[model samples]
Target: MHNGFMRVTALALGIAGALAMGNAHASGFQIRENSVKNLGRANSGTAVAKHDASVVSNNPAAMVNFDRSAVQVDMTDINLDASFTGGGTTAIGTPLSGGNGGDPGSATLVPAISAVFPLSGAFDKVTVGVSVDAPFGLKTEYDPQWVGRYNAIKSDVKTVDLNLSSAIAVTDRFSIGAGLILQRADVTLTNAIDYGTAICTASVPGNLGASVANCLNPAYPFRPQANDGNVEVSGKDTSLGWRIGLQWKPTDHLTIGASHRSEIDHNLTGKADFTAPSAVAAVLGPRVADQSINAPLTTPSVSTISVEYDFNDAFRLMADYQATDWHSLQSVKIFTGGGGVLGNEPFQWKDTSFYSLGGEWDLSPAWTLRAGIAKDESPTNDTYRTPRLPDKNRKIFSLGATWNVSDAISVDAAYMRINVDDPTINGATSSSGSHLTGTFKAHADLFGVAAQFKF
Candidate 1:
């Protein structure tokens, strides 16, 4: 029974991964970009001090620099593009229809919002603030004719976070801050394919192939593919997490910062829908409860550190490092309301780290220029990797500037380019020895703009 449950869960993740074809993982295909200022700096803030609302993610300690009560609002948009580089159809009883790679479907309209407002300063320069932000999200789609449809079609993940924080300047050169994180996340996984092509194969034992085709055909008693019958699962999870940070200005011209957030365990609540061929449903549906399956959500952890250097009068450098415990995502286990196993699957990910370095140059009294570079490692293993994510290590280049509209306001704009190294997966297989091997390339471009207000 435990093995059966595990298999069912694996199948569920496989389905989920398929729908989230371009980007989905233990972190749920989400980006860490939240504030316009950080985007301009390649998200590097481990060290320098800033008075912007972006302090919510950078270093809450930096918020101490803001004197008056202030509020800042920000919005960001992300665009992603991905394409399959190499992979051929499996002829060894492959359970997929159609040919190889197709058009690279695109996803857009990704929007994020965040706000910060400071309260009374009780301690030396102490300020309490509340912020809401989208810390992570993903959107990936593939052409209907892609041969990997059975493994993935379209996958989307979204997350909203609320943080209550406080920061104080302990000394002229030292500051500290902390935040209580409340998180809400949602995931949707979908896969659509021709039932006949998915389950029928001439090499199968007995007359199963003939039966599969006959039952799934449009003219037959069952028309599962008529509307491109799909399997879908949607769920939401809520979790509690926390972060602590410190900023030290050791010298008049240098600054340093560090921060950490603890992991949160989430109990997700959601539903699933499975549209199977009538003949197959008749045999499997009775054993399961319905045409659907449901379960709890997964939990993951993230940690980051950053630093900056202020040189001369208006020039500074930035660097950031982040680590995500993807290894904790080794498996996804779903639970029914009664504590029964609904589904579970292996994620088989390794702990991963990301590094970024950037610089901010004050081009003029009213204009600030930014540029940065970053490198991120992949967490997926070759054997377990599939078209859904087809992930690889990547590099990012970013540039931006803030125009001082007046003494009290500024507008920031940034552009970023992402490049993924081609990844290869060999010896992919089905339980029956069916094999798959391929190479994949992933990339995307993002343009961002945000306005900041100060009083």
Candidate 2:
């Protein structure tokens, strides 16, 4: 009974800690599709561009550039294509049977909204704004009987952030701002469990006598993938963080801005449900029963510096650099409701950086054209990469346009293409001693549109 409990706990915690972690459209599962204008320029100058209400989420200090109350609504569609080609897969030194998982990526739609209000009366020097957006999300599902099913079958995570910010113009050339962030996240993960391997590895005597020979016997009821089980974990949490930013206009045509957002820590509590074969369940008994679990997760902090140069009324140039503190997510530790530590899964992710260059051309009194390019570094490396996060460095290209229907209303549209470097999985081993080896070819396309209204 003791051995059965330990096995169950390890499998439960392993899936809960590792598989439930991260994966998304952006590097390290972070989402950057908060504004269509920013997307048009590959996110360049996001912190310094004081042109729209989206500034409320990128850099609150930019709000000082607005004098009127305005609102913006945006919608973005992300289409991802991720496919795996199997080289070789093995389970407990034996070749595993199953085809390569089909394309696991899916198309998703993301929405964002923001409003900025410039104060009057005694508070005329202050500008306040509010924004709601999804900063992180992920979705992937592989075939149930795929060779890598033991590693991960399906993973879904979503997050929502609400920001309230205020900015004050300290002087004609300088402005400072601060904001409070409230974020909520939820995750659901599922994976296949090799019951044959579990029963063979168990130390408890009786039944089949806990031997590999018995497990591999043709007549045995439990043999490798022949009698597989399943486990699912679902969790949710909410947390708070803060951000600060500043913008400086050294000259009439030059602007520089910097911003930092703190990391939010979440303590997620949920249930782990298990389904085992009848024969396996009869032996494991209550050990395979459902139970409550908890884990701790910390989202990374981000810092950005942007510069914008307005050469003339019709032309503008911008560039920016961003850094993410992904090293903070070294490992995920699972715990029981009574505070007992189950185990931990190590990620050992490194910090990542992003760079972009963009420009805008005023084609006509009512039209503007935008173009940009960017490079994004991946935090995961070959040594620690897994099927759950087959991340690689990527390059991005974007084009956009804005139409000023009138002074009170405008529309913006943008398109982006991302090319991800092909990644190889040398021999990612699962908790059940399954090794998945393969190469992944991946890419993504994004389309966005936004409408702005002034009151």
Candidate 3:
């Protein structure tokens, strides 16, 4: 009973915080864009040399032949369509409720940025550069009155990375390079509805039947029940982390590159709010609850190996393989009032691998064309999968082009389509018997443009 009470208390506090923050948010903080064509192919820019910026994304040493120092800027935009399908209507009871669970709206409008530069003539054989990028992040939002509101309303996981690197040409036939990285990240997690108030209301004399019956099935539950959706939690956190990389060029026609990016750990500190009707509050302890917590953010390390072939001056091909040590994110830890622990849930993620292939074709003196493809794996498991993070393995196809507008300037544009397979999450009852199960599907589209300047 004590454990149950403690869990209930934790749930109550969590819900209160979410409500105060305004429900309907999600978090899966993973950013997937760094370059235009590269993004079209699952972000595989490590072994290709199509432009001066390529030196920064792949190997700094590739700059050994740059006639002059340069700068590159890229902007990427994204749109998405996500939904919950194949489930009957139902209600839940925690804070207070009278609604059904079905469809949660999809998320959209993501942006990513990056910049790079070279050292000097004194180090003609070497190049130094820096770039800012996001490797992991996501955004999910549900309706305010949706059954899943209590589980997640608005979720945003984002990050900022700053990297410093040096690339050197050991010989005309070989180039080696390395890098040091620093990163800062922030996360906002929001949950809606109040289960405590809903549970108490359901326990009243004549309300036990609906609660008992719905608790037995896994589809959905109506209000005035222990698990009848009425709880919400919302908060934010920020912290610091770092990574490293290396590259090798064995010949003018072949460039082989390898790199490693370390994990980013953020300690999120923020406030929460809770709201319930008076009747519900009488049983839940209050009509309003407010407090703060420290949430932890984990960004994993990635190791990659890739090879690019310059078949001739007008054509090139590249392929890469990357392993992300997602296992580093095993669980979520939040600190609450009096510096004590509030919630500690297992993330239970494992390492994931990615594969990519790309090709560039010089169509004429003034135009270049590019195409690529790749596969990306998800890090979340079925048991832990929530509406906020309905992630699954996905396939990507991309197309891009560059127009040489002048002797010192070039413009680039690229497009990508991501196909996300339907993802599923099996239901499990809390010790209190609040059952849950869901089938989720989602996908995204992206457009990117950039300007390359040489002096």
Model 1, TM vs. native: 0.84
Per-candidate TM vs. native?
Answer: 0.84, 0.94, 0.80
| Candidate 3 Cα misplacement greater than 4 A, ranges | 1-29, 40-42, 50-65, 88-114, 196-198, 201-240, 286-288, 428-433
Q: Model 3: which ten-residue window has the lowest total lDDT?
A: 17-26
Order of models, best lDDT first: 2, 1, 3
lDDT of each: 0.61, 0.80, 0.56
Put down candidate 3 lDDT per residue, 1-455, tens digits, no spaces: 11221222222121111211111111233455666656544455555454646445445555554556566777777656566643322234333232433333343444434344455558667766676665555444566655455455655555556666676767765666666656654455555444442453255333354454444455533233433223334444444444344456667788776766666555666654555555444444532355676666556667778788889999888888888876766766666656876565555776787788888888998998888988877776777664555567777788888899987888888888777767775652332333345676666667888777787
lDDT against true structure, model 2: 0.80
Give model 2's clash tally: 0
- Model 2 residue 61 CA deviation in Å: 0.5
Per-residue lDDT tens digits for candidate 1, residues 1-455, read 11231123323332234333343211234466677677766677743447467677556777776776556666555555555644433323434445555534354544444344555535547777777876665666666656555455566666678888888788989989898989887777665534333333322223343444553455654222232345566667778888888888889877778877676666556665666556544533433243334544444466777777778778888888888766656667766555677655566878788888998888897899998888877777776776666677778888989898888888888887778777675644322122446676556676778877776
For model 1, what is the C-alpha lDDT against the true structure?
Answer: 0.61
lDDT over C-alpha atoms for residue 413 of model 1: 88
For candidate 3, report its TM-score.
0.80
Worst window of 10 by summed lDDT in candidate 2: 5-14
